[model samples]
Target chain A: MTHKIDIKNLNLYYDEFHALKSVNMVVGEKNIIALIGPSGCGKSTLLRTINRMNDLIEGVRITGEVFLDGNNIYDPGMDLYELRKRVGMVFQRPNPFAKSVSENVAFGLRVAQFKNKKKIAEIVERSLRAAGLWDELKDKLNRPALDLPLYQQQRLCIARLLAVEPEVILMDEPCSALDPIATMKIEEMMVELKRNYNIIIVTHNMQQAARVSDLCGYMLLGEMIEFNKTSEIFTNPRDKRTQDYITGRFG
Target chain B: MMKLFSEKSIKKALTVIAFSAIAALLLIVVFIILEGLPFIFKVGISDFLFSSEWEPQMGRFGIFPMIIGSLVVTLGSMIVGIPLALSGAIFLSEFVPRWAMRIIKPTIELLAGIPSVVYGFIGVMVLAPLIRDYLGGPGLSILAASIILGIMILPTILSISIDSLKAVPQSYREGAFALGATHWQTIHMAVLPAAKSGIIAGIILGLGRAIGETMAVIMVTGNAVILPKSPLYSVRTLTANIALEMGYATGMHRQSLFATGVILLIIIMVLNYTATIAIRRRVGKK
Candidate 1:
């Protein structure tokens, strides 16, 4: 499989505390990869580093390389704007902008300076359909995004990411705030999305990782303990620490 | 068996206290209206609203110029004060570190506590002459009044705008940044829109302060009885007119000043009502 993202010896720190320590992993193209860890284990921090979201925080220091499409993202001359345009992110909780549903999906395209109104409208509809929310929300494009139900809002956020046409989608516990049914819908959506875009999701739910991801990485104390196919990692793991964590021996 | 009081009694007492406070405010309005009603009825409504001549000794009581002066001064203050206050608020809320916030927040609060009279004295002794020299006026005009009023209302606008901007959830900003928005872009698109109603409320409150302000404006505004012809022209605002001439005037003259008070009250009431409606609509949309 061709690698879409390659992280080599990446380390991240917030002030004095080391958050991600020398993490190395490669995510294949158009595949779903899940990072499973307990709270404070740096799963979210690792996910954020892929898109440079941690740049907003003060006293954050990063070391090593994150290559997107064979180019080092940490290169001093790399434009963050263009990099982020190619790599989109969805948050844990639904965070639709204080705008209409159509406007929410159109936000990134508008920011990227796409002036063709017809093209924007077509993309909005296509993105909504891709996220499997078009049938329910087709008639209410003018409604505020926040007025939607939690599950629908999450899907709308997904549609918004899709509108940007990013190669990779990073999700930080995207279904953590959702109910079981909503989580199931999102899991189904992820399987469908894998045909077109590479996805890296950090989740606390071991079963979710088992169900939705083709590859699973088990992390603890800011270190990657094991990375393998999800079936092998769950059924025939090599590392004892990975086994203990997968079986819920200790978080 | 141990309970001596019912829930109904506590509810009743709370309702009565709340209504009483509201009723007390209404009574003050009614008293002002009743005391000023005789002159309003005698002079008719159109003259009181549109006439510019306000000679109390000769029984001429036109309040149009003072009304125009109040409008111009209040608008000037808002134009100057809102942007300064908003920028100060954004810096305080978004850029200032936690340790620095402890020092800066209180300094702003200290501005709010400074007496209006001290602000008046500053305008009279310092700012008026500066404007006179630089802007080429009589050291006291609508421009001077606006400058003084703007300074007086700065702390109010800044503190409230900061609170409103802080009240916006961090999730919105994170969402914008995660979508690749720069700091200023995130603030402009997400943070400012979310905090729009609160910032407008702060501006409206500052406007109320400007419209009703007396001592500071009276000290610097030349207090001429004519409407301001320009930024450098002298004028007397509604509040200043009342404050300046209310003493020693007898009968209908005193009543006419009270009528001016009624007119000022009505203007502020309209402004407050519009602001309240706008804020409610924004909150509802959110």
Candidate 2:
């Protein structure tokens, strides 16, 4: 399997407190990988480190490297903006810009300085279709994205990232605020999306991980306890901590 | 039962206190209208508003010059102040470290604590001379007043704008940056648009301050009651006209000054309403 992202012996610190300790994992291309753990287990922190999203926080320090494709993203000469473009993130809550649906999708293209109006419109439609939002949102393209229902808004956010044509999509609890139906819809979209792009999701729902992820990693206290095929991780966890977590004993 | 009675009495007292503030404002509005409107009718509305002549002793009380002066000076101050205040707000909110911003913001706010006379004093002693030596015409001109007023309104605009910018959710910035937007691009495209209504409200409030200011304007504007030909020409604002004349005027002349006060009140009310409408529209859209 071709490794799309290689996280090598990564350690992260927020001031004096170590947030992620000696974590390492390789994510395969065009597949869904889920990271499951309780809050403060550093699953989100690990995910953020992949795109240097943690760099925005003050007093954050990192050692070791995250390699995207073949390039070390932590190199001194790496362009932060370019790295983020190639690895986009969807936040926990749906955070659509206070703009029209079409404009939200077109934002990334505009940031890349794509100025042709016709080309932007084409890309916006394609991105929305890819995120499975075109049929419901086609006539409402000019309406404000914030005015949409929460599920549609979340889909709009996904379309926004798709517009930039990223290689990897990181979701940080993308459905925590959503109802079960909405969560299921996003999970369905994720399974479809992994056919084209690598998806790494941090989810609290163990069933969600089982349902959508091809591979799964269980984390405990900034440590990746076990990583294997989703069925093996769920049905026959290797580590005691992973077994305890999957069985609802403790996290 | 005794505790309940006291609680009811306390609520009544607080309600009376709040309504007293409203009652005071209503009294002032009533007084200004009563004293000003009769004089405006006596002089004839067209002559009072449009005629340029203003020899109050000779019973020619046209206030066209001061009206124009107030409008021009207020507009000029906005032009000078908006860009500086906006950039300062962005820098403080986005780029500055927390430690540095805490110190710098309070220091800038100290500019507001300084008295208006002191601001006028600096304009007279420093700015006016620079303008006179470099640009020609008298040191006290409309340009000088505009610059001074712009500086005076800076703290108001800066304080409000920084708050507006800071109020934008951090999620928007994260979303923009995750899309490969540079810091400037993120601020300009995402953060700024969300804060537009608030920034505009700050600007209009600053404009209200510029127009209603009396003492500092009187000290720097040369108090000339003429139709100014240019920014460099000496002029008198409505606030300046009222303050400069109210000390020693009889009957109709005093009423004319009150009429000028009425006009100033109207301009300020229009500005406040515009701010209300702007904020209301933003809420309605959401």
Candidate 3:
């Protein structure tokens, strides 16, 4: 299978604190890959590195490579705008823009320079439907996005990402802020979304990693301890650390 | 044992204190009116508001020219000061690093602390001559007063605007960036819109400072009791008129200076009320 993203010896630092330590991973095309680890294990940091969202933070320095498709995204000549357009991100918290629900969905497409009113409306409807949010929100398109319930807001954020038509979607604990029902809905949406796009998700729920992801990568202390198919990783694993973590021996 | 004290007595005492503070402010307004009413009645309200001629020695006390001068100079200051202050605020809040913000924010605060007299002296020695040479005429014109006032209130606008910009939540910026908007685009569309009312309040506060300023303006405004035809024209503002004439005048003339004070107070009150309304409206919208 062709890889959608490849990380080679990627290291990240926030000033003196080493966050991600020489992390190497690959995400296959049109498949769901989940990074599971303890808190502060650098799962979110690694996820942000794919879209270069960490570039917004001051005193952050990254070494080595994160490639989207065949191109090194860290290259000096790479266009950040174009790179960001192709690789969309959803944060742990649902952060819908302080705009109307429809506008929030249409924001990414607008940024990509789609100015035609009709085209934007169609994309907004399609994206919302794809994220399974259209049935509830179709009537309240003009209401502020903040007015929606927390679960709907999370799905709206997903719709926002989908609207831009990105090839790779990086979700950093997308369901962490959600209740079990909302979490299940997002997990289901992820499985459905994978038919059209590659997905990399960092999640704390081991069973969720097993249920939703095609491949599971277990990380610890800023290092990837195991990478294998979800079934094998759960049923049989190579690393003792991965086995210990998966079996709930110790984080 | 503490609950033995009657709640009514405590409530009455607190109410008295609060009412006393408000009463004190109202007393100043009353005093201004009392002092100025004699002159205003003698000069006639229409003549004071509309007449151009102002001669204390000949007993002609028309305030139209001074009022016009104040409006012109304040408007000029708003034009020069608002954009610079807003941009300074944006730079401090969004662009500058934490270490740089530490240095720059205090420097702007220090600018606010400098005495108005020092600003007056600076305007007289430096800006007056520069204006005279560049724009011609006695140099100490409405333009000179405006430029000085602009510099004086810049710190007020910058500090307030920076605070407003900083008050915007980080989620707004994150949301915009997640949508693939550039930093500048995020700031322009989200951060700036979020902080618009606060920025407007800052501008209004700057205008209040510009309007009420006396010493710095008097030093550079040529002290001419004439309607300002242009920025280059030497003219006297209402505040300057009161300050310049108060020391020597007695009776009605002195009272008229106090009347000018009342007018100045009214204008400031209006500006402050507008700012309050703007802030409330923004809050309501959110």
Candidate 4:
């Protein structure tokens, strides 16, 4: 299977605090992968590495290569905006822009200077439809995005990412703020999304990983302890720590 | 029983203290209206407002020129100040490093603490001469006053705007960046729009400060009681008129000054009301 993303010996430090140790992993195209671990286990940190969001932080030092479609993203000449355009992210909380629903979905295209209003509207409608928000939000496109319910807002954020036509969607605990029903809705969308895009999610819920992801990687103390098929990781983790964490032992 | 008694008494005392401020404000408003309205009625409303004649000794009481002067100067100051103050705010809030901003922000705020008289002095000695040499007309003209008032209101506008910009959620910025927005695009699209109402509030406050400014305006506006033809023309604002004439005036002249105060009060209240409505509209949309 062709790899969508290749991380080679990735190490990240935030001002002498080692966040991600020497780590390597490859993500296949068109699958849902879940990274599960306790808090501060570098799961979210590793997820941010793909689009270089860590560069926004002060005093962050990274030494490794993250390649998307066989091109090293860490190269000095790489266009950061281009990299992020291809690799979109959804945050832990629903963070739609302080704008109308249509404008929120059209944010990416507007930034890219897409001047054709009709085409932009079409993409906005299509993206909202893909995220299953079109039927509910179509009439309320002019309403402020913050006024929406949490689940709808999260789906709106997903639609925002879809507007940019990203190949890889990085979700850092996208359903952490959501109730079980909302969480299930987001998980169902994730499952549906994997057919067209490589979806990498960092989540704390082990059961969510089991239910939605084809592949799962258990992380411990900035290291990838074990990664395999989700069923294998759940039923028979190769590492003792992974098994301990899976079976309700110490995190 | 002793603790409960003391608590009730303390609450009563605090309420009185808060009410005292309101009482003082109400008293002042009533006093200004009582003193000013009779004189306005005596002068006839249209002649008082529309006629440009302002000579007190001749009993000519028209304040049309001063009204125009105040609006023109305030408008000029806004033109000069808003862009500079807003850009400074955006730079401090978004682009500058924290350590650098810490130093720079306080230094700009220090501009506010410097006495307005000092700003006027600088205007007289430096800015006026430069304008006269290069831009023509009297050195102390509407243009000169506007520039000084612009600099004076900079800190007020800048600090409030920075606070508003900083108040924008970090998540909005992250959301924009996660979609491939450049730094400028994120700020322009997400942060600025979210902060619009607060920034507008800052500008309104600065407008109030500019309109009510007495000392620097009196010093540099040349105190000419006429409708200004250009920014280079010397003009007298309403505040300047009151300050320039309040001393040794009696009878109707004294009431006219009070009327000026009433007008100034009305302008400020209108500005504040507009700002509240603007901010409320934004909140209502949300």
| Residue lDDT tens for model 1, A35-153 | 99889999999998999988878999999999998889999988887778788899999999888899889888876778999999999999999999999999999998989999999
Model 2 has an lDDT value of 0.92
Model 1 DockQ vs. reference = 0.58
Give candidate 1's TM-score: 0.95
Of the two candidates 1 and 3, the one with more favorable lDDT, higher being better, is 1
Local distance difference test, per candidate?
0.88, 0.92, 0.87, 0.92
Where does candidate 2 stray beyond 4 Å? B281-286
List model 4 lDDT by residue over B160-269, tens digit each.
89988988888999899999999999999999999998899889999999999989998888889988888988899999999889998888889999988888889999
Q: Please provide, for model 3 over B14-36, each residue's C-alpha lDDT reduced to its tens digit, 9 standing for 90 to 100.
A: 99999999999899888888887
Q: Is candidate 3 or candidate 4 better by DockQ?
A: 4
* DockQ (model 4, Cα): 0.73
lDDT of 2 at B213: 91
Candidate 3 lDDT score at position A38: 94
Q: TM-score for all predictions?
A: 0.95, 0.97, 0.87, 0.98
Ranking of all predicted structures according to TM-score, beginning with the best and ending with the worst:
4, 2, 1, 3
Which candidate leads in DockQ? 2
| Candidate closer to the true structure by TM-score (higher is better), 1 or 3 | 1
Worst 10 residues of 2 chain B by lDDT: B277-286
What are the fnat scores of the candidates, in the order listed? 0.46, 0.74, 0.37, 0.76
